[model samples]
Target chain A: MEDIWKGLMHAGALLFGGDPGVWEIIGLSLRVSGLAVVLATAVGVPLGYVLGSRKFRGRTFIQVIVNTGMGLPPVVAGLIVYMFLSRSGPIAAFATDVLNWWDPAAAPHDAPRLLFTVGAMLVAQVIISCPLVIGVTAAAVGSVPLEMRLQARSLGATSWHEALLTITEARRGVMAAIVAGFGGIISEVGAVMLVGGNIEHSTRVMTTAIVLETQKGNFDVALALGIILIGMAFVINNGLTALQQSGSRYER
Target chain B: MSADARAGKSEPIIVAENLTVRYRKRTVLDVERFELYEGETHAVLGPSGSGKSTLLRVLGLLEKPATGRIWIDGAQAGSADREARLMMAAVFQNPYLFKGTVAENVAYGLKLRGVSAREREDRVDAALARVGLEGTQRHSALQLSGGEAQRVALARALVLEPRILLLDEPLSYLDPLIKRKLVADFSEILTTSGVSAIYVTHDQDEAMVVADRVSIMHEGRFVRSGTVDDVMGLPTDPWVADFIGMETALDGEIVDTEEGIARIMVGGQIIYACSMFCPGQKVLVGIRPEDVMLFAAQSEVPVSSARNRLTMRVEAIEPRGALVRVALRRDGLRLASSISRASLRDLDLEPGDDVTVLFKATAVHVAAAQGVPSRL
Candidate 1:
């Protein structure tokens, strides 16, 4: 209890008293998670729309895969990304060996290494969250009535116009998908920790920094970081919730 | 030019040939040939599960037929053709309003056509007025009642000014009073706007009031297609007669024919009919209830051109809207007569009163009763 009270005081100081180290970690965490969600949304929304709206062969098979991926563990995703980006991994070896054929005179050791970098963390986070976005979005878009699409076409809408109208109708659900993707990645510590190596000033994020502080017996600092992370999630989720509710005025 | 067009008549706006639609192994629609004349409202009348809605969808370019070609204004098109679809509009059974205000819903099609904002507002207002929904542009579409939402749906399609409007039982979900009002208003709008339309419905009364031509569909094919009077007054088959409200169908053999009048024996009584059937021909005599008139049994037999009159005891009297239906029975022969409420009151008739039933020879429609058993 005493440590929790101390941690609350430290959280306030770190948030408002110009703590540069804590703020840097927070900023990196936001950047990595934000970019990862944005990338996932870009790919997931259209793919989900196609999966929801059209009936073709193998669609059910793909939907089953996406549903399975939605339950995937973030640590497993991190391990998979780690293997791919490691120095002696397939990607590194492919880049070095395959590109060497194009530039025989270039240095053979010039292959770009991605392990322990922010890019690696982003890849792991995206892998952890993208299937969630797709699964939620597919269900959301599928729930829109087929009559709405037929009505759009009856109103002389082109195929593109019909898709746009359907997406607009499912706007609330799609917003929920975006929030789910963000929540899936922002609170995830294992993936970012394993892929980013949590180096200070470069790769350290809020979750990883909290783990390091707690390991080093800095209970107050660890609790403070935890508080900040929860506060961030609360504010972002509330903002999205407000947006989702605003769209209800248009519904019955 | 076709013969009708050469004679200065309206030309066909849409023509479908060999339109067939199948679902797995069941064929839902098998329209061989259909034509919608310009500025004419054609009604497709049928019972439930008759595939009338499927026929409308195929004609509206919302569904592609398995083996067919559709030409709109002499240009071939299918469900995949955007330009062809833009030339037509549809209103379905449910309103199916988009998520927005009435103005937004009405202006949707115009917006898709890239109409300017100011023009869209003007057209939307005009269409709302046409549907008698004036000054409701800003009202939320989802907050409307069933009838209002349907009016918005109608306005949404009308604002586009499509060449043809396809209506799939648009008023089916409304209450009786609202449906009657909408039907009247819709008829007037179709007449005044001169828009070619195909209205699909199961109500024959509505079809009679609204359609310039009607096609009676059964089992995925049109069993009868002609003017409403031609189909209703002179049904060629027992199914058509039964469907068109000719409830009294008596099987009888034509005993004699002279000067287009045939005497048929039914229920140990002779019935005079205006038919071309020869003597000894088995036939079905279809009688419309509205054509039957009743008088007190003690009253003097009215001297009129009607050739059939019989004494029948009233079995039951049922009130149907503004009219009353009296069921009559005599010597095991049953018949129904639809009369005005005033007539029923004037006669002071009851369930046991014997009355004289009179109907003209022209009212008796005779069809060959080969395979169809009598429904009497």
Candidate 2:
């Protein structure tokens, strides 16, 4: 208990004293997770809406695959992304050959190594979070009454316009989906640690840094990082919850 | 005039030919031919699952029939024709309002049409006023009472000013008082706007009150279609007569015909019908419940011009809103008579008490019992 008290005090000092290293780790964590979640949402929301609202052959099969993907282990996603970005993998040629042509400076010596980089971490997190967004968003879009779509169409809304109306009506569920995706990736450590390589001062995020500090017997800093991560998650979730609740007022 | 212009003026606003809608291999709607004149309210009256709503959906362009050619405002309409759809609007049984203020809900269609915000607001306000919800523009649409929400839905469709409106049991979800008020309001709106409408409902009274023309649908097919009085007062089929609740049907055989009057034998009693029929013809006789007058069996025979009287034993009496439904049985032939509750008490009749059921000879409507089964 005494040691915990000291660690808490030390963690508070690190937070308030503007420790650049800790702040950088927090910033990197936010950047990677934020980009991953944004990208995933941008792609997943429409895909989910289409998957949910339309009826076609293999729709049930696709839904089953998406539901299964929602429960995919983070380490499995990380491993898949790792193998894909490795030197001997199929997608590695894009990083090695295509990226070199696209930007030689960024890919010096014709070798675009992405295995231990922020981009690799972003890919892993996106893989880990996208299925969650898809599953939740699909359910949300499905929950919108079919009458609404027919009403919109009867009111002269084209297919695209009706889709937009449906999405607007389901805004709360979509927001929840995005927030869930953000939460899933922000607090995740396995995928980031595996794909990001947790390089010191480069790829080390809050969760990876906590693991490193704990292993090095730097309990105070580890505890501080843990508190900051939780605080960040709480703040984001609070804002999203407020938004969802406000939207619910119109759900009659 | 050009052919198109002539068609626009002379042709019906909607014409559906050979329309058949099927679901899961079962036919849901099978309209052979139908038309809706411009600026007329045509009510499709039927019971639940009777394909009235399905017909409305097909006409509203919300559902495509399995095989049909639908002409909208004299133009052939494809399944997903935006122009065709824009020419009409619909109000469902339950008012489905989007998540917004009433004004925003009403303005949604205009907004989709790229109307300016100022014009949208003005039209929304005017439409709300038309529905008697003038000041509810800023109210939350989702929080409205049932009637108020339905009015907003009407406002939403009204603002669009479509050439046609499709109402599917729009007032069926409201309480009786509110329904009455809305019905009156809707009647006025329909008359003043002169928008061609197809109103679907199960209530015969509602159809009579709102419809300029009515089509009685049963089992995916129209049993009768004509002007309101024509269909209600002169139903060609026994099922239609029963469905409208306007008359009680009794199976009888014509025994004599003279001077354009047919004397029918019903349950060992002679009932006079004021319609020409050949002797020995099997017919279905319909007597309006309100036309049947009841009197105590012991009372002196009233000096009146009513031609037919049968002494029937009272079986049951039921109160039906401002009137009483007295069920009378005579030799297994049952008849329902609707009379004032006060008159029922004046008669002082009870179960098993004999009463004379009297009605005018003209009150009996006779139709050939061609399709009517013997046990109907």
Candidate 3:
């Protein structure tokens, strides 16, 4: 209990005391997770819309794979991204062999050695968050009644326009899905650590910094980072949750 | 010009040819041809799952027929053709309003057509007023009751002023009082707007009230299609007769013919009917309850043009709204007569009372039905 009080005090001081180190870590965490969510949403929404609204062969199989991916361990995603970004990985080999085959003078014939950079952390976080976005978005879109689309089409909406109307009807649920995706990757530590390597001044986000500070016997700073991470998650999630609740009455 | 001649002169706004829809291995609809003339209300009436709604969907271009050609305004149009689709609008059983204000919901289709905002607002207001829901533009559409929601839905379609309106049991979900009012309002709106419409319903009364012509569908096929009185008054098939509320259908054989009338043997009782069936032919005689007049048996028989009169013992006296249905039986022959409550009171009729039932020979419809039993 006393440690918790001391940790809260340290957290407040760090946030308000012009501490560049803590702010940088916090800023990096927000940037990586935010970018990851945006990228995931760009791909997930349309894919989820198709998966939710369309019927074709192998749809059930794809749905099952996506549902399984929703519960996938973040460390496994980190490991997979780490492998692809590694110097001798297939992606790097392709970049050097195929991409540079016709341009020997191309800068950085490899995949730019992104294994221990912010790019690697973003890739891993996106993998961790994408399935969540897709799964929730699919469920949300599926929950919109078929009559909505039929009525829209009967009112002169083209097939594409009808789909847009359905998506608009499901906006609240999609917003919830996006929030869930952001929440999934925001405070995550394992994937970012494996891919980002907790490099100081480069790739150290709040969660990774917390682990390093704890390992170095700097308990106060670690606890402060943990506090800040929880505060950030709580504030963001609650803000989005308020938004979701405001429009909830019209959902059904 | 006469109304008939005018109707003949106007081209059909929508035409469907060889429309067939199959689900799995079973065919749901196989309509060979259907036409909706301009400024005419054509109703497709049937019981549930009779493919009436499917036919409407195919005509509205909401569903592509398995094999068919849809012609809108004399041009062949595919189901996915947007310009053709925009020429019509539909209101379904449920309103399916989006999450927005009533104005927004009503303005959706206009916005899709890129109507100017000012024109959209004026049209939306006019449409809402037509449905008797004026001054409700800013209300949340999701907050409306079922009837109000449905009215808003109607306004949404009317705002577009489509060349054709497709209504698939739009009033089926409302309460009786609301449905009655909406039906009157809808009939007036359709008449005043002169929009060609295809209304699909299982309700015969609604079909009679709102349609210029009606097609009775059974098992995905139209068994009979004509003017409302023609189809309801003179059903040529036993199934169609029974479906159209004929209270009594008796299986009999034609025994004698004189001039335009035929004497039929119905359960050892000879009955005269105006039919073309020759002697020795099996036929079903249909009688609407309203067409039969009941008189107290003890009173002196009054002279009338009715050629068929028989004393029947009353089996039951059932009240239907303001009328009483007197179910009468004589030997193996059973019949029903509908009389006003005042007539019931004047005659003082009761169960087991003897009453004389009289009907004209022309009131009996004779259809060739080989083995149908008497239905009361």
Best by DockQ: 1
Q: Give a tens-digit lDDT track for model 1, residues B65-158.
A: 8899999988988789888888889999999998889999999999999999999999999999999999999999999999999999999999
User: What's model 1's lDDT at B184?
Assistant: 96
Model 1 lDDT per residue over A51-93, tens place: 8887889999999999888999898999999999998788989
Task: Please list the residue runs of candidate 1 whose C-alpha ends up more than 4 Å from where it truly belongs after superposition.
Answer: B1-8, B248-287, B295-308, B312-336, B339-355, B360-376
Candidate number with greatest lDDT: 1
Q: Candidate 2 DockQ score?
A: 0.70
Report fnat, model 3.
0.74
The TM-score, computed over Cα atoms with residue i paired to residue i, of candidate 1 is: 0.87
Give lDDT for model 2.
0.86
Candidate 2 residue spans exceeding 4 A from truth:
A94-111, A248-252, B1-10, B246-287, B298-336, B340-376
For residue B310, give model 1's deviation from the true position in Å.
3.6
Best model per TM-score: 1
lDDT (Cα, tens digit) per residue for candidate 2, span B174-270: 9999999999898889878979889999988788788888899999998888677557655666688667654345678989888877789877678
Model 3, range B1-376, lDDT digits (tens) per residue?
3334546878998988898999988999988889888998889998899999999988988887899898999999998788899989999999999998999999999999999999999999999998989999998899999999999999999999998999999999999999998898888888889899999998887888888888889888888886665566556666776566554467789897889799999877888888777788888666777988999998987999999999999998888777888888888677778899999999998899899999999888777774644321
The docking category that best describes candidate 1 is medium
Candidate 3, position A59, lDDT: 92
Better of 2 and 3 by DockQ: 2
DockQ of each: 0.76, 0.70, 0.63
Structural similarity to truth (TM-score) of each candidate: 0.87, 0.86, 0.86
Q: Chain B alone, model 2: TM-score? A: 0.78
